[model samples]
Target chain A: MKNKKPELVTTAATLEEVERVFEAGADAVTLGHERYALRQPGHFELEQIKEAQQIARKHGGRVYAVMNALMHHDEVGELAGYLEQLAPHVDAVVFGDPSVLMTARQVAPELPLHWNTETTSTNYRTVNFWAGKGASRAILARELSLEAVLEVKRNTRIEIQVQVHGMTCIFHSKRELVSNYVRHQGKDPEQEIRAAQRRMFLKEDNREDQRYPIFEDRHGTHIMSAEDICMLEHLSSFITGGIDALKIEGILKPLEYIQTVVSIYRKAIDRLAENPHADIDSGWLDELKSIQDPARPLGTGFYFKQQIY
Target chain B: MLTQTVQSTIASPTKRKKPELLAPAGNLEKLKFAVLYGADAVYIGGQKFGLRSKAGNFTYEDMKEGVAFAHAHGAKVFVAANIIAHNEDFEGMEEYFRTLYDIGIDAVIIADPAIVEVCKQAAPHLEIHLSTQASTTNWQAVSFWANEGISRVVLAREVSMEEIRQIKKYTDVEIEAFIHGAMCISYSGRCVLSNHMTNRDANRGGCAQSCRWKYDLFEEAEEEDTETPQIGKTELPMFSEEDDSFTMSSKDLCMIEHIPEMIEAGVDSLKIEGRMKTVHYVATVVNTYRKVIDAYCEDPEGFVFKPEWMDEILKAANRPVTTAFYYGSPTEQDQIFGVPPKMAKYDFAGLVLDYDEKTGIATIEQRNHFAVGSEVEFFGPKRDNFIQKVEELWDEEGNSLTEANRAMQKVKMRVTQPVKPYDIMRKEKK
Candidate 1:
């Protein structure tokens, strides 16, 4: 039997970007609120999230709110109230912390929850565990190989999402590295380090050549890969592997970049749906590569070669 | 007069159960010393499926003997099969659980819920303690795991004292918190830095400790150069004058002085953090904490903090100690920034392998240099430390020796008091 094409999921920062993604043929858009999300610049307020939800619904698309932060105790105390206000405004909520799952189940048991704790959901059993715990969809870890994803799909009925583009997060820490560095330099950490203005890079002492970009916010520090993951050529493998959605992880990116990447993936999925054995055209790959930041390189990432650290 | 009477009544000592003093055992020898020195429970890793993969973990035969030895000493042994299992790991898991159950392991510590379910099926008789790698910081999460049949939950180190008190109020599940040891820069153990950088899966057991590595931060230049920028380009250093430092490495955790508060908070276990330490380390740390916990239990109402316990802890600590996230969020001072060298006040001398009461001599395996006349302190599980000059020394072959300096060298030393096999010996640092 021929496999169905996976839905194209993209991220948006603005109301206009939401419309742009819908026009570019995205089936779903992931939006984050300012207080609960890790991304500082792109997060929307409650009213903006409501508008984005309306725009998504008008275009026959869904909006998944990104609340995937490793919340502290006080932060968790604020979750149920926020989730109560947000339950009616969005289609589903994506989260990483287990505490968030329990809180969401308590406040809004009817809401759909997506489990995407970066590196935790690597196998079918983990997916099954989360699915049994009330998560409707589980995003597989980025470190998994194609065969591993297929194995997860073979074992479970829960929907799975895989990242198809954008820079991958290599490290996540609760310690605010940039603020601590500012304090180490004899400056006031609060005054010197502004979350929205912070842009830092770190390189190993031994390997001075490769540098990874780091983002710090109220939540914590997130270090991303030097090269963005571009898996345009591997869409068929993911689609046939029974992946339910293909995610493009650049909510803070430019609107033009979002539209371009979304359009390219939309065409690729359409091509694959028409002909299961068809390969992504070379022209589409070049178009997808053109939207990436010039400073960051592009690679196939762990999709082709497994990282061994 | 009425207010004074009420205050005195509140200050009176009340009976409370002693919290478990749990220590880490990287090997069988460390396990024995930890149990003997004062640990109520010792957590050890088997040959596979544990976080400390580099440690000299116990084999099945060694684990059986270690459990027997710990039980004989009235201490419990919890085996760590706590790695986040992958698809390939599930093949031998049933056999592993069966072996652990057959060997009489008190409980199995796990991080993955799938593994918890596996244990429920494979070894229904065994208890399952949730590892801190689960990052459980709230009461609802604890309640969730408790409903899932988890007997205990190791609260994440980031949880505050107030939060712990509330969690205890909300749930009946046993709560374990880390009282001493190294801290992860990430939340719990959910980090991929080692995996992405070195290809070693931190979740699977091969953590390269990338957080401890020194890194330099730089800001990207705003203006583009006339020359085309290349990928992986080496930019000029932003803050070059500053020393290369471990921006992410945290200070070691020590809560020896806060024993009364922890006990009052209803903590079920106080866990020590090292599984890759020496037998001397296990013995010293366990003994010191045991004394502190016992003293607090004996007089909780009149408890006074002791400075000597801090001094004793410094003898075993290689890094600066901080009460990490216990009071609240850690500040800049709690983190170790610059790559400074560690300072220790004492050096491990040796372990007493056997004692011959007839000759009034103890057979020792030397770890550091100790001469015939040097003053060394001998301490054991049930005995107070007594200083004695090494008046007589002999090799295993019975030849007279003036000094023992070689590593793992067997030597005999005459002592005034009887010594057991796991008794530790140490000398002040020169």
Candidate 2:
């Protein structure tokens, strides 16, 4: 019997990059309209999503629309209309808020639901609970250890997705912190605020080594990890352990970064699926190193070290 | 005489169903004080499976006594077992649920669905209130939880007043929202800054509160830029010396003025969020909010926001207050920016252990230093607050003393007015 390998999921930076990532080797590309999505790589209107869907169909790839914003009343009121328009264009919807689940069930019953409640999707019972509610997959939190991830996969009936490579969100605030800080400094926010600019980072007074990248957008401020998580070496354990999809977060990266990461992870997943006992490939690490930002270090990220404060 | 008048006025129930005043109780003592002070319900952390691992959590024995005390006073006790559980944390969880149910806990505030499953299967009769850690900000999510058999849903602090009203309109499930407490800059349970910075897992229990730590901003160098600015190497410091160092700290939430708005929004419970606070804090906050809630409920049309309530609460408030996310998105003003705690105008002097009305002498257990000449105010749940000067003082041994400086020392002080046991005595700060 042939082994079942987890699908390669990449966040498409643009509608044009959707086909590029699918060509590079992604089974699915996740993107969405910025109004409904939080910290996405790029925004896509319904027409653009339809275009991406056509492109996905040609390459036999799937498209997942991220509608994972913690919905307020206004967003909740407008979600049904957006989902109704978006229903036909995407294969599934990735959501963190349960409001999206209820809305999707009513408006687009056929589309699959991928539960991705950033930090709280820690245990199997919660994942299974969402699975019982018709979620096809659970996106495990980046904070989970490898052992915990396997345990969740072992117990759950639905597909489990884990981030394989890219910047992990360490903090998300609904407040416009940078703009507010600029205003507090008696400067014009339009000129001083680094809205979505990846160049700015925060260094704790006590910790001089680490510089945490920060950005502000319509959803609010998001602090990215100083280290991007590279799970290429651990791809065997996840794919062999029965994780359904591996998500590569392309939120702050360029199209080339996404391409390199997807291809490397894809090759590694294939190699491991073909031979479970294969030796670690130094060449794959070398390819990923080509695009690795020296300033933004890469680590295994909670896979080995317990995240303590 | 004042107690009788206050009691008689509230004896007649309000026409509208007023929201329950819920308070946090870190231990059995805080629980009793919370119940006595006017909290309709008190949420407590047990010895296991709770997020505040450092808090003095209640033992099963403590739970029984606390539950009994609350229930005896017509108040409810809810256990907060709201940790986002890992696989190992599930060990003994079923037994824990059964034990909580056996203890007659009113409900359990839980965030993890898996733990909720274990709880339901083990103790089906145990009521569940979804924790704000789940971040349920919309009506459909509330309804979804309702469909799942949750009795109540504590709306996320990020939720707005208008969103709350809309949620209540759609679902019959009880809505609980925070009216007072420290605000997390990140959405509750969504941050891993502590985890990434330190080895502690914030969701399970240990939160280093790395957000409250001071951080200096640095600009990243462009690609191919060899001269990347190193920490302390740049001539121009990112922030001026006078700028707030605690960049991410939010002003604490105090909704004393918004009692009517909360009640009108159809909130079933107004939660005060400080489980790790002192008994004095629990009493002061609960007492003030209880009076305000009762006043508004008794006469919604004639209800007026009282400045006195704000003044009373400031004695317990550690930080400046803001109506976070309720009025609108909190701006720069809502951030604390390294300011010190607001200086209190008063200090908790003592608790009235026994009051002799005929002799007008009160036996007190001292909390802070107070002298015989100190001007003190006596207040309690039943009676209106009254000020009097301490004319004379004696030790527990009946020896005359000029001052009560020892912590928890029993002192006898002559008072100007009749006092009751459990009455709080506060001295004005000089």
| Highest TM-score against the true fold, candidate | 2
Q: Candidate 1's residue-wise lDDT over B30-109, tens digit each?
A: 89889888999999998888888889888999999999999998999998888877777788888899989999999999
- Per-residue C-alpha lDDT of model 2 across residues B185-304, encoded as one tens digit per residue: 888898988998887899988899999888876555444443432222231234677776538889899999988988888999999999999888898899999899888887887788
TM-scores, each model vs. reference: 0.93, 0.95
> Could you say which candidate leads in DockQ?
2
Candidate 1 chain B: worst-modelled 10 consecutive residues by lDDT:
B226-235
Tens digits of lDDT, candidate 1, A137-239 = 9998887777777788889989999888886777777667777776777777666445324356788788676667777767677887767778888888887
Chain A only TM-scores, each candidate in turn:
0.92, 0.96
C-alpha RMSD values across all candidates: 4.3, 3.4
Candidate 1 segments whose C-alpha is farther than 4 A from its true place:
A1-3, A195-198, A307-309, B1-13, B224-238, B353-363, B395-399, B406-421, B428-430
Q: CAPRI band of model 1? A: medium
Interface C-alpha root-mean-square deviation of candidate 2:
3.3
Let me know the TM-score candidate 2 reaches against the reference structure. 0.95
